[model samples]
Target chain A: MLNLIANENMKIYRRMRTWILVILIVAIVLLTGILMKTHEAPPSSNWRTALQAQTTQLQQELTQVQGKHVFMPARATAGMEIQIKKNQYEISHNIAPAQYTAWSFTSTIEQRAIGVLLTVFVAIVAGDIVAGEFSSGTIKLLLTRPQTRARILLSKYVATLIFAVFMMAVTIVASLVIGGVLYGFANASQTYVYMDASGHVQQMGMIPYIFTNYAFNSVSMLMTVTIAFMISTIFRSSAIAIAISILSLFIGNTLVAVLSSYSWDKYILFANTDLSQYVFNGPLISGMTMTFSIIVLVVYFIVMNGLSWFLFKKRDVALT
Target chain B: MADQIAVQIRNLTKRVGNKTIVDGLSFDIPKGEVFGFLGPNGAGKTTTIRMMVGLISISEGQVLVQGIDVEKNFSQAMQHVGCIVENPELYKFLSGYQNLKHMARMSPGTMDARIDEVVKLVGLQNRIHDKVKTYSLGMRQRLGLAQALLHQPSVLILDEPTNGLDPAGIRELRDNLRRLAREEGMAVIVSSHLLSEMELMCDRIAVIAQGKLVSVQTLSDLMSGGERHVITSFEVGDKALALSILNRLFKDHVVDDDNHPHLISLKIDKERIPDAIQALVEGGVRVYGVSAVTKTLEETFLEMTGDGIIA
Candidate 1:
């Protein structure tokens, strides 16, 4: 069995797509960072200049509505003037400031970019783990070995996991290095997360936040890998399996969002995608719990692996 | 026979969907002998070999290798058997040496010295370090053989081992397999559609057709199944008169050709060749020469299969 695992690792390493996926992920992350660095006026950034510009626009709208500077009479208005000025100040303050520098800008980009790249990397690695063997006609040689079919499939699964870990490590390390160089590492230790419902934002230490983010990304990556593996085993075609897996990753969240308006959203695989949303946001959407989402994902993982093993063991590999 | 039997299949059958691929095929290969499996295309040779190697499941009946049931203890039974079915698919990206080294690791007892010996045995020492994709077809076949022999199994099953080799390569493979069987006490079962090759290499042969075993016998037994007749050709003058005299003397023994008057062939037993020669000489026809034409293995195979041996 150890020999089989080693052979599986060798096969995975030799495939061109595995390296291509890794390089693609690293390239995308670095390119996005460079683009963000060069493009100083990116619309996503928050700067004081843009904020003041927006504040002026809101004041102009108010002037247009009343046809003049609407100031209350100081003596006869009975404190109405003070209340009106307070409301105006509140509206002006609410307009977002655009004091966007490297620290704030790179953080948001890194988070979203890493999440998307990690998801894609997981799907690519897991989707082709078994299907490529079928396409290359190597599955017959593998099955003819003196080991059981289940053992062979399990070894492949383990190898896929190893590849997933390697890819994630590469992506994370690349992001941190490029992010530090471009956006000076001063605010790197600050946790910038938005709070939901209460209209507030909380700041945590950077190391703990980054660790939490890594853990969350790992869960999502596992979901992608396991799901793609199951589909690959069942379909036995790399393109089809990969297409279906990625399409689900993109569309599944939308489905959960639309379905959550009704009562049946909890059962969908997409509902589990935003595992960090509740913790980062406020209360769960429609009173969902973290434990419930974890359970749902765990069940999905078990079912996918079980089905993969069953079908792979029973498949007749006559084509290979 | 009990001590000699290396692999035994009794009433073995396999079916894919509704079509029966192997139907009630039975054969016993003895120890230290080269057994040839001969059949036309799609004659269930691959299916039978797959079943023997525990690659495919047997629908009915069982396969016994060295007195162990293959289905019951496939891993243990397979430990004593090595096989290459169809095109010996190996990892193209891996070097020849790496491929064999990996296979050697499967059997824990095998050593690096054994791998070296097999690599040299296959005459691939010079190019064993090169990737398999860069090797020629003959070289790939030799590398596959080296891998199969890495564990030194007692029984080796090769399906169409010499399918695409040149004449010299084929001869080399035949000599090597013969030497292995003779020297190492290994039972080798090789399947091929080439009758002449099998005739030269196999000690015993089992011919299959349409998923059925047609005959199983020693090479000599199969060769001597029909009447042994010697065809003697003679170059003579006045072939009609010479033929009439020869036909009258040896009734039902002469075959005359109208195309050439100076040539005629007479089919007779070896013992009667002298008598026919004396009578032909007395007929007053000038005889130039006479020589006996022996039957080739091709003719025997054609007679057995009821089809032309070479298409």
Candidate 2:
């Protein structure tokens, strides 16, 4: 089984396309860093006075909106109140609004790159791993071996997952290096502030925040990769598999939002993909808990992989 | 004797939609023999080969490789088998050596030394390190064969192995396949529409047409028309007189030879050649030469398949 996985990895890494994806990630990170550097706001040394002035201005806005009849006035006032409390917390704790440091840049890159680019890249690789063999007519060579079909499919699945992890690592390492070089690397111990699920201000170290973000994003990445793999195994055309996976990736969140009014919408895949919402913000739909989403995700994971294994192990491979 | 049978296919059938592609075909390929599958296009030769190697699903019946059921115990059955479905479509982006290595890893117990040996066996040592996209069709064919032979399987099955090879490449493949069967005692099953190539390479040939088995005979028996009469042509100086004499002796046995005035042909038994020659000589017809023209595999195949298109 290990030998088969090595073969799968060889097939993936030996191609120039796989390496191009890594290089593309690094290049995009560098470009993003350069752009962020040029547009960065200058650091304020008098941040304490600035925080007090912002609190006073927010208080004025809060009073003006208090008696007004507007759409979502309560929600607007709640957001303003959270901002005032955060400013007060920073002033009392002597934690200035974060400056543009290497850790901050890494955090920023993680937010943008992991959500959009990394998922799409991993989806492309997973989508092609099985379908590529069929389209190229190499499936015959691959299947006419001593290994069972189940083992072969499992090897491919494991290899694709390893590839996703490797790509995420590359994204992280590249962003850190670029962010460190462009911005100063002095704020490794900085704290990130956010409103927790209970609407209370919470603070954590910068490094732990980045890791938490990755851990949350990885859940979605796992689902996306499995979807791509299932599609790849079921369909013989790599183009169709890749296009469908990417299409679903871009539209999953939108689909959840469009259907969020229905009670059953919470059971959808996208609703459960972003587990971080349970930790930082509230869930998309009311009554959704961390346990519920995890259950939904596990069910989806099993069904998708089960269908893949059933179809792959039984379907006849015709001449392509 | 039963132990010598490398592959036993019984009632092997394939049906797609409402049509049957292969209908209850049964055959046994023993060890140390080069077996040929002869059929026209869409005649189920490729389908049968695919079923034998467990590439396509078997609709009915079963394929047994060295006593292992192919569909039931696929991995064990496949361990004794190596096959190329059609064109040896390999990874064009990978070097020939890398492609071989990829296959060797899937098939356990195949060492690096075995890979090198198969490379040298296929005469691809010089270009083995080059990417397959740079190889010609013939070289890719050899690499495909090397990949199949890497495991040293006792049963080697190839579907149209000579699809895109030059004359020299075809001869080289034929010689190598024959040598593998002879020296290593492997059962090499080859399928092709080229009757001449099959005649030269196969020890026994199984002919099929329109999903039905037409005939299965040894190469010599198939060529000689098995117990049937042969077309014997006699070159004579006096064609009209020779025809008249041959007609008077055996009217139904004489064949028309008007196309060539110097030739008189007969479809006759081998034992009566002396009687015809004596009658021709006594009737003042000078016979220059006499020759028995045995039927080639082409004629025999055409007769069996009712002149189906070879392609």
User: Whose DockQ is greatest here?
Assistant: 2
Ten-residue region with minimum lDDT total, candidate 1 chain A: A74-83
- Model 1 misplacement above 4 A: A15-17, A41-111, A196-203, A254-266, A277-289, B226-235, B250-253, B257-263, B289-294, B308-311
- Model 2, span A210-310: residue lDDT tens: 88998898899899888887888887778888898888888998999999778789888988999999888677786889999999999999999999899
Sorted into a CAPRI-style docking class, model 1 comes out as acceptable
Compute the lDDT for candidate 1: 0.76
User: Runs in model 2 with CA error above 4 Å?
Assistant: A41-48, A59-78, A81-98, B309-311
lDDT of each: 0.76, 0.87
| Candidate maximizing lDDT | 2
Measured with C-alpha atoms, the lDDT of residue B182 in candidate 2 is: 99
Q: Could you tell me the TM-score of candidate 2?
A: 0.93
lDDT of 1 at B278: 78
DockQ of predicted model 2: 0.81
